[model samples]
Target chain A: MSEKQKKASAYWKENVRYLFILLAIWFAVSYGAGILFKDTLNEIKMGGFELGFWFAQQGSIYVFVILIFAYVRLMNSLDKKYGYDE
Target chain B: MDVQTWTYLLVGITFSIYIGIAIWSRAGSTNDFYVAGGGVSPLANGMATAADWMSAASFISMAGIISFAGYDGSVYLMGWTGGYVLLALLLAPYLRKFGKFTVPDFIGDRYYSKTARIVAVICALIVSFTYVAGQMRGVGVVFSRFLEVDINTGVIIGMVIVLFYAVLGGMKGITYTQVAQYCVLIFAFMVPAIFISIQMTGNPIPQLGMGSRLNDGSGIYLLDKLNGLSTELGFAEYTDGKKSTIDVFMITLALMVGTAGLPHVIVRFFTVKRVRDARKSAGLALLLIAILYTTAPAVSVFARTNMINTVSNKEYTAMPEWFKNWETTGLLAFDDKNGDGKIQYVADPSKNELTVDRDIMVLANPEIANLPAWVIALVAAGGLAAALSTAAGLLLVISASVSHDLIKKVFVPSISEKGELWAARGAATVAVVIAGYFGINPPGFVAAVVALAFGLAAASFFPAIVLGIFYKKMNKEGAIAGMVVGISLMLFYMLKFKFGIFDGGKEAVPGLEKDWWFGISPEGFGSVAMLVNFILSIAIMKFTPPPPENVQEIVEDIRIPSGAGEATGH
Candidate 1:
């Protein structure tokens, strides 16, 4: 393969790795903290809410928005690292 | 001015703005009609997508659903927003790189099968039409309540207004109108939320106010007070679960995947310029959506607490005007089953006398809080905006599927671009009328049917699109088989459990309720269907021949970030 093709493959691999890591965080917040461990997390308080209730109703959504932007930033940097940025 | 006049004025003004934008940005070509000439900025596309994504269900019904269902309603919240994460990370950028006008165009090309394209078009039509029906109903409700028109008249008016812009401007017109709609809706949504939040917790932001101590010198968290009131009335705790844990998990997963899979929402990503813009636009859309989603739970808390404190055990004669107003519309009913003048809003089926339709919580919220006439009118306009924007988006997809995918691409490849554009316009006009008809003469189960649209999208399209992009060896055969099986399984479950088919002409098949597979409701069954699709596709691909070399090359091309400029029209 050409050098540029090799570099593109490496960049794609890195991108997938970042995607999985970000998605794992996404799964943890919504399904894990919000639904599965909600009762356990409810034992802790954040201001006026049980931690779990907050996660289910409010916290997971906040995390989701943040996670998207974080992924965008990570991918942007990865693009630069592999000289794929337009 | 009275609330009625105010509503008419605001709604009229918003309609005028939409029409003006439609005229100003009318499409000049087929590409313009399909993808807004592929020139929309990421931020503007984000706001448009926010408007497109936040349908009438989110604007008018979600808080009400949450208000009644309590913690179970978290599924809608997590499900909807979480999908954007999947979109941003997994789907949007690649799809944007593919640079297509319609989803079926991508599916058909990527799978290299006309039959696969046809299946996608069918799924897209069913999903879009079912969803648009709910939006039309939302428009009708706002009109009937605020403008004093019959529901039929309201629906007809909504149809005419939508037909004007959607036919004239296409995606170009709809994109700008949706941006304006995003403004009107977010403003309308936030104003009442701020008012109620301050009144309840002495805080301005509804998100924080929901967690703040009550302003009534109770020193208790608002949620705690709500939970106390609910249990006092024999209801489940406001912060606890009612549905089984597995059901919640499954439903949330279905909604998230469904949101990602929805054709209308996914098509919005194609309007932007670059792969990076697609990612940015998804983030912005989620940020815009998060504003209302987070506020919805807070609004539920406020509305619930206010309703319980104001009406429970109160004499009917002393009930608030909002209650009487909604009662006139038959949305709020009080049976007084115990023969007492006092009303009891509780969880006990026998003792509860108040039957507040879940749609009323969001609609009646402004009046319930005694907000200004202008704010009430703004809400009417906001609800119309939300419904109209989404309806127009979905109708465009339906129209494009007919004109671009089916008629031109498949049946008559010789049709000129101008002919195809006119055909799309004609199809959109008919679609709007049909959606309006469903709105006026609603099939008594529009919302339930609409919920099934998400499940269908989740089961059929999400798996196919995701696998087509990520799994290089996924052949046309496995993809088609997977979509067919996934959609058929979801349809069978919905038909048998929800509609009660196969009962020898009985409306409800016996024992279906008790015999749900693993206690998963039909709404949650999409997740199982999706899992089956994934497993079936992978297993089938192992045995089937791999995709053609050119198809694999196309996949590799879309995976990269560069060279995503304008999309080429078929």
Candidate 2:
């Protein structure tokens, strides 16, 4: 393979890895804590909130925002590492 | 001033601001028309996307729906917002790098087929129109309730304002006005919420207020009080959900994927200058959207609690003037069954004398809380902003589908730029009138069709676009087959279950729910259809020839985030 193709492939591989990690967290918060394990999590409480219900309504959304910004920070650094930054 | 005068003033001022922005940002070329010349800043695009994504439903109906549905409504809260994560991580950066004017542009180029492009256009139009009709109706609802105007007249006025900006400035005009609209809608949504939050819990922030102790000297958490009240009326606990876990999971997945696939939202990323800007703006858009989303549940808790307290077992004649006003609008009604002069809003359908429409929760919130007339009126203007901004954005997508995707790419490839621009404006004009007609005379199936739009989008575009980018070997045959099969499967399922067309008809729908595939609702069936699309596409690709080498090269190119040029028609 050409040097450029190899570097591109490497960059793409790293990008895919980051996506997997980030999306796992995304899945864990919303589907896991918020839905599937909700009954179990609701056994705990945070102030006025049941732990599971909070994740379903409010907590999951806050985590989603944080996940995106975190993805942005991670992707930016990766772009710079791969010298793909403009 | 009273509510009418305040509404007129605020709505008038906000309309003038939109018109002013439209004139300032009018598109001159097809590129400018499609993507604001691909030069919008991240902050501006972020705000525009927020306004564009948060439609009339988000502004006028979501909180109210959440208020009644309680924990079950998290499907919307999580579904809508989680899609931005998919967009930011999986879709936005790549599509922005492709430098396309529309979603179909990428599908067409990547699949190397006019067939793929046309299929995409049809899907985009169907999804957009289904969604847009709801927005126009929202505009009409807001106008009639606040200004006391006729619903048809309200729709026409909405049509005229949208026609002016969307036809003249296109996406360029829509983006800037949406920024202004975002400011208006968020401010309008937040003010009353903050007020109610303080009144109920002594917390200024609505999100925290929901979890704080009530200020009524009861020292109980607001949610606990709401739960107690709900149970007292034979309703489920406020934080508990009634939807089956499988259905909730599938529905949330469908909405998130469908949201990522929406052409109007996807096109907003094209307006930015870089792939990085696309990523940043997705983050910003979600952050901006999260502001309203997080507060909605708090507003829901407050509104539901206040509603039950005010009217339950209360004498009908003693109700507030706002109740009478809403009654005249036919959104709220009290029949006082058993001839008892008091309203009974119990869980039992037979005993529930007071029938309240969920759509009124947010609109009537300010009046229910006795906020100032100006704050009440501000919601009217805010609803208009949300509706108009989204309508304009969808209109742009519809017009672009007609002019750029169909005319330029398919039928009349030899057309000049100026000629194409005129065609776009003409399409916008026609789309607005059609949308206005639907707004004035909405079909009986309008509400049912809205959820179907998300299912259709998920079944078709999400799979097609994802495969086009991620799997280099995916051919036109696979994509075309997948889109056709996916969309058809979704429609068949939706018709069979949602409309009961394959059964006896709409009346048979309740009985057919027992036979749902794996107990998933029609709204969540998109996930099933999408999975079938993915599987069938791969199977078809294994037999068919792979996409051309150049197409594969384009896939590899979009993977890197550098050198994204201006969004172009070609």
Candidate 3:
């Protein structure tokens, strides 16, 4: 394979890795903390909210917005690394 | 001015502004019509996307649903917003890099099959049309209540206004109008929320106020008080889970995938200039949406606590004006079953004499609190903005599918650009009329029917688009088979359980019952169907010849962000 092809493949691999890591964080927050472990987490409270309930209702959405921007930043730098950014 | 006069004025002013914007930004070319000439700024596109994504359901109905469902309602709060993450990371930037006018354009070119495109067009049409019906109904509901016109007339008025803007200005017109809509809607939503929050907890931010202690010297946390009131009235605890964990998991998953896969929402990314702009736009859209979403639960809590404190066990003869007014609309009904001359709104099926339809809480909030007439009027205009903005977006998708994908791409490849543009406008006209008809005479539970649109999109498009971008080896045969099987499974489940086909009609399908498969409701089954699609597509691709070299190259091109420019017409 050409050097350019190898570089492109490596860029794609890093992109997929970042995606999996970020999405895993997403799953952990929403489905894990919010639903499956909610009952246990309810034992703890945050400013009058059951911790799990807060995660489900408010925290998850806040984290999701942040995650997207983080991904955007990560990808922009990744694009620069691979000379893919304009 | 009186509330009625105020409503008319506000609604009239907003409608005129939308029409004025439409005339100012009329589309002159196919590119202008499809993706607003692909020149929309990220911030503006973000606002338009928020307006487009938050339909009548999000604006008018979600709080009401959250109010009643309590913990179960988090499905929507999480499911809807979570999709943007997937869209940003998995779909939006890649699709923008491809620079397509519509979703089926991607599917057709990526898979190198007109047949796959046709299948995608069918899915897009079904999803958009089903979704648009709900938006039209929302517009009708707002108009009839505020204008005191018959529902049919209200529907017709909405139809005419949407036709003017959607057909004339196309995506360009829709984008600017939606920016206006987002402002009107967020103002409409937030103003009342701030008022109620201040009233309830002396905290102006509803998000913080919902968790704060009540200001009535009760010294009790608002949620704790709400929970006590709910259980005392025989209702479940406010924060307790209602549906099984698996069902919640599945429903949230379905909604997330559905939100990511929706054609109208994905198409918004194409209107922006660069692939990086697409990522930023999705983030901006989520931030805008979060402003509403996070507020909805707070509003739900405030409405519920206020409703219970005001009305529960109160004498019927002295019921408040808002209660009596809503009762007249049949949305809030009361029956003195025990003849005690007192209303009992309990969780017990037989004892609860008051039946409160969930839709009224948001609409009646300002009146319930005795706020100024103008606030109520603003809400009426806000609901209209939410409904019209979404309907316009969905209608564009429907028209593009019919005119661009079906007519120009598949049937008449030699059609002139001018001819195709006319066809798109003609299709938009037909779509608006059909949506108006549905609004006038709704076929089924509009919101429930719209939920099926989400499930179908999740089952059909989400896997195809995600895989088509990520998995270069994915072929036409796999995509077609995946979409067909996925959509067919979802339709069959919805028809069998929701509509009661099959099973010899012996008993109702176990939608939320223990008899369900792992207690997964029909709404949640789409996640399973999506899983099936992913597995089926990968398995089929393993045996089939790989997608052609050119198709693979296109996939590679979309992955890289450099050299992405304006999307051109086919």
Identify the leading candidate in terms of DockQ: 2
Instruction: Report every candidate's CA lDDT.
Output: 0.93, 0.93, 0.93
Model 2 per-residue lDDT tens digits across residues B366-418? 99999999999999999999999999999999999999999999999999999
Against the native complex, each candidate's DockQ, computed on alpha carbons, is 0.90, 0.93, 0.87
Model 1 C-alpha lDDT per residue in residues B209-257, reported as the tens digit of each score: 9999998986999999999998999989999958999999999999999
lDDT of 1 at B426: 95
CAPRI-style quality class for the chain A–B interface of candidate 3: high
lDDT of 3 by residue, B419-455 (tens): 9999999999999999998888898656676987889
* Residue pairs that clash (backbone atoms under 3 angstroms), model 1: none
State the C-alpha RMSD over the true interface residues for candidate 1, after superposing those residues.
0.7
lDDT of 3 at B57: 95
Question: DockQ: which is higher, 1 or 3?
Answer: 1
True contacts kept of each: 0.91, 0.95, 0.80
- Per the 3 Å backbone cut-off, how many clashing residue pairs does candidate 2 have? 0
Fraction of true A-B contacts recovered by candidate 3: 0.80
